[model samples]
Target: MGYYQIDCFKIHLTILRILGVWPTENPSPCYIYLSGLFVFIFTVLYVVIYTMNFYFLPQQLEIFAEELIFYFTNVGALSKALAFIFLRDKVKKMLEMLESDMFQSDNPEEIKLIQKAKEKSSFYWKITAGLSVSANTVNVFLPFVVHVVFNVKLEFPVCRYSFIPEQYEAIFLYPAYLYQSIGITSHMLYNVNIDTFLLGVMFLAMAQLDILDRKLRKVTDVCVHTNAPSGSIDKMIDDENAVAEIIKCIKHYDAVSEYCKLIQEAFSEILFVLFSSGSCKICMCLFRFTMPAETKYFVFLTLYTVVMTLQVMVPCWFGSRLIEKSSQITFSVYDCDWTPRCRRFKSNLRLLVERANRPITIRGGKMFLLSLATFTAIMNSSYSFFTLLRHMQSR
Candidate 1:
């Protein structure tokens, strides 16, 4: 398959384009205007408007938590969307690298590995997108259902534009609510799409590593004549053909390393915001417990907490796997029949092993390493914040 067939992400990238955040070198005026509109919506409406609303709200834990959840969630989406826009050139380079021959292979086994990784990525995209859109649909429409069927007062699924005097809320509620539904739906899709796309890149990178390991294991394989002496096995340890194969594998490893470096460069800020803000988001999610025990909002918050946790945890998990898989290449080389190999091959292999000795670490924004330990630290910080909030409430 071509570069592990990562073109499967084309559809999602197109979605981002429609969402007006996809970067273009010279977008048409219409597209530029569309992009500007989203920028205004995210900055002026969500972040700026919501923050002002939060500040004016009374110091109740429920109000702050509710507003904070939406605000923080919006921040995640906005930051990632903006990062993608500004880092467009880096993203283009990364995609070019992904599609380069360095990540491609003719071997059936390696092709299968690529296929599996692509399938897994597509599966995640479906699940995450479906869940995200479904959750947003419920948030927007469920309130209207309550108003219609049970005569409960209607509410906006987002900030109520506290700047608008409540006396006239009735006049604007319908149109304002319409804007909320559309804006939030767009934001939700962007959130899931960008996240899955990032993680999918990492997943595919790990798959390349898997193929690299397998190639290393077979790097010394050689064919021998049936009449050849058993002693000839030593000479065949690394034939010229085997040397060529090992070189290709070495290049594959290098490509994967470079691919990861590009990912780090493109997503450094995005990952930083994810891990750093994850705790506060989780803390706000936890504050849902402060709501009435029988409240349905509790269930929503519970699910939201899970989504946020997965958002942080999945990156760390993939990152740890990337480090593990890349590091194991050295051992794979050792496992092959390389002891009696030629001097040139041995020297090259030795250099590769030396480089692999230091496991490739994908740091989150040049800060914490993206591993389970980092995930745990983030969760701990979230719990600490939650605990501190509880104590404050008790006082």
Candidate 2:
């Protein structure tokens, strides 16, 4: 049971709950009520601020550019929130399936394979989580630090709108700052948790593929050496056992296939939104970085660009690995000693090869394939946009 445990994902869920993006598993009445109330309040404030920024902000290029960045930041948050709220049940079901499949194995070899996969997955999750937290912390607190050190009064408006009344500015300033801070941070957490969880699932899929690859090779070896045994009876028994092992491998492969499909279904839209917003964010951040700006904002923009780039890269990296691992299944089947297997076993092998040839991929909204190639394309497009913006700014 201890070996079957998945603790890293649990820690992620805890962070989600703490950030108010996810409700408890069995929330009490008061907890549910308060959580609902808070979400509603947060949503309302977010909409008001977003609407104000979009419609009422001045036409100055610098202000408008800053507002656009803010708009997309909130857009990322809102999309993440909506995805979690709508897709949480699907995500939960996926997790349940993952846990059941990954932890139920009793074979020592299989267990070791599973443990290795889990370790790799945990490493990826921790690194991504740490980077996300560090980025958010700096982005959130840099203004205050700059204000203190430079002796400049920093205006921390959720969105820059011209509507705040002078008479109420003094009274509402602190409260407004507090409200915006909470709203933004919660939204940021939603982004972090959803992405991290999605990555966790991807990593697990990779682990499953690794195990499947090993099992596949072992089955092939057993089949290939069927003639090594001296007696006819021994050969027959070995053949029977090899067939059974192949059947088991087929079932394992099927389970992994289904798990990959579930992940695709659950996170496709979320990944789509992330890619779309991320591209825009990168372009804008890069543009802002190239323009003349204060030291504080320049640093913020640089960090923002890095964070956005990582957000896109994480999925692409994992998704590409998934594709690579899955594609190996066909080759693993071919590498086995299939020459000695019976008709039925060969038939199953052929089917496995056919299926594996199709390649398991994580698509963004079922549109763009999430792969290293896609990541490269995104980077190229962002740079192109940045170049175009620079040209216009120069003019």
Best by TM-score: 1
What's the CA error at residue 285 for candidate 2, in Å?
1.4
Candidate 2 stretches with Cα past 4 Å from truth are 2-5, 101-103, 138-152, 220-233, 387-395
- Cα displacement (Å) at residue 10, model 2: 0.6
Report the poorest 10 consecutive residues by lDDT, candidate 1. Answer: 222-231
lDDT of 1 at 316: 93
Q: 36-87 in candidate 1: lDDT tens per residue?
A: 7976785446676677776568766677678788887788777888888888
Clashes of 1: 0
Against the hidden true structure, what lDDT does model 1 obtain?
0.81
Best model per lDDT: 1
lDDT of 2 by residue, 277-309 (tens): 788888888777766788978877777788788
How displaced is residue 14 in candidate 1, in Å? 1.2
With a 3 Å backbone cut-off (N, CA, C), the pairs that clash in candidate 1 are none
